[model samples]
Target: MDIKNVFQAKDVPEAINLLDQYGEAAKVIAGGTDIIIALRENHVKVSVLVDISSIKELKEIKTSDDWVEMGAAVTFTEVMDYFKGHKEYSGLIEAASLVGSPQIRNAATIGGNICNASPAADFVPPLLALDAVLTVEGKEGKREVRLEDFLLDKGRVDLNKGELLTTIKFIRLRKGQTVTFSKLGLRKALAISRLSTAVYLEIDDDEKCAEVRVASGSIGKHGLRERVAEESLKGKNLDKAAIDEASKVLSNEVEKRLAGRSSCEFKKDAVEGIFLKAVEKAMVHNGDGSYCAMGTQYYPRAAGKE
Candidate 1:
């Protein structure tokens, strides 16, 4: 890797100033799990690496009465720890746990996972399902954008020169609402996701699907919302039949999007099962018509436990 300077930023303003000064040659480095590899492989050319990993403001995870705000430099391990037993945020925890491996999770920031914009990033689909919003800062000012809109294409986001993603914010999950994630990989541990799905479900008092969001990974140019599948489930009782129909809808959509790709044939069929798993994981019910059970397991392997 060819590099000229390294700046250790103390705060968001300092990082923004360094990036503005260095322009396109400067790249933010948090965790360095992804950027370091990119630099080594010549995938990216950088003259400056602004280390924001130690910035206090960038490592915060704050929650309000109705929302949660996480700094861009917050690591996956931190995410998992903060939301560990919170059933409503189980999907977010599961996704964080499933990233690369324990070491990678400790060193991999959610912001980096997001900024890297990998098609198979474990944390993205769950965040998308939550309709998360991003707060970006630059020399000019700060601006917010929906996560769905911020993602443009494979390995791309709407981030501009001199701008740094500050925090990701989303509404807190409440009664009757839960998010769940499921994925397929070559092996249980240390394998990148081959396909994944996240479901944000809201079942009303009548046991009908009130609102549902389905997001997918490794099935498109980037993580995407499966609106057709969501539409099929809304207003319907979440019976096996309803879920199966939604799964079929997702299967069809995957076939359409991945039409000419070599993995299309397999993914189209496989997505149905994966989507169902995520939906089922979020469907735990209670007598008060609320989602009461956190249908996720804490994987010891992900926690670096033998």
Candidate 2:
């Protein structure tokens, strides 16, 4: 990696101005967890590096009555700490905790993960399931973009030369709503996901599904919503049979999307278990006792228990 100049912007506006001045020659570095590797691998070349990790305004997390707003520079550790023991959003906390290891989590920013836009990024699916919106600031002005639309393709985003992602905001999970994540990786910890699922579900008093949002990573060109699977469960009672059917729907969707890829067969089968696990977790956290008895047999026991 060769860099002619390195500028540490003290604030968001200064960062935008620096980006505008350097144009495409400048690359933003927050935590440098992904950008450093890309630079060393020669995947990205730039004449200037603008470090925004020190910007205080970009590192805070705030919550309103309806939404939670996380600064672009907020670390995974910060996210984990904020949501610790909060069952409604446990899936997101789990995702953040599972990104890399302790050191990496301490340094990796949520904005960096989204901007990296890797198909296998662990955080993307959960955020997508939650319907996240991004606040991007540029020299011209500030604009908001949906997380799904901001991700254009593998390693590509909708951001322009002078823009900087400032914050990620999402609707807070409310009563009767639960979001959960399940990942199938090569190893238990610090492994890149082979297949993963995130589910957001809400059930009405009658036990019929009111809202369902399903998203997956490493099973498509980018992290995407599984509408077919979601449609299969919407307005239905999320029983074991319904979960099984939805899992199959997700598997078939994966098979169709990756028909000829070498990992298709494995992924097709793997997604069934992953999707079911995500749904089951979401149901368990639904807080209504609706699904408590549906799948209790499969729940993992405590460390000392049989």
For residues 74-193, write the lDDT of model 2, one tens digit per residue.
999999999887788877898888888899999999999999999999999999999999999997898999999999999899999989999999997776677889998888778988
Candidate 2: give the clashing pairs. none
> How many clashes does each candidate structure show, in the order listed?
0, 0
In order of appearance, the predictions have TM-scores of 0.93, 0.93
Off by over 4 Å in 2: 285-306
Candidate 2 has what TM-score? Answer: 0.93
Best by lDDT: 1
State the RMSD for candidate 2.
Answer: 4.9
User: Candidate 2 local accuracy as lDDT?
Assistant: 0.87
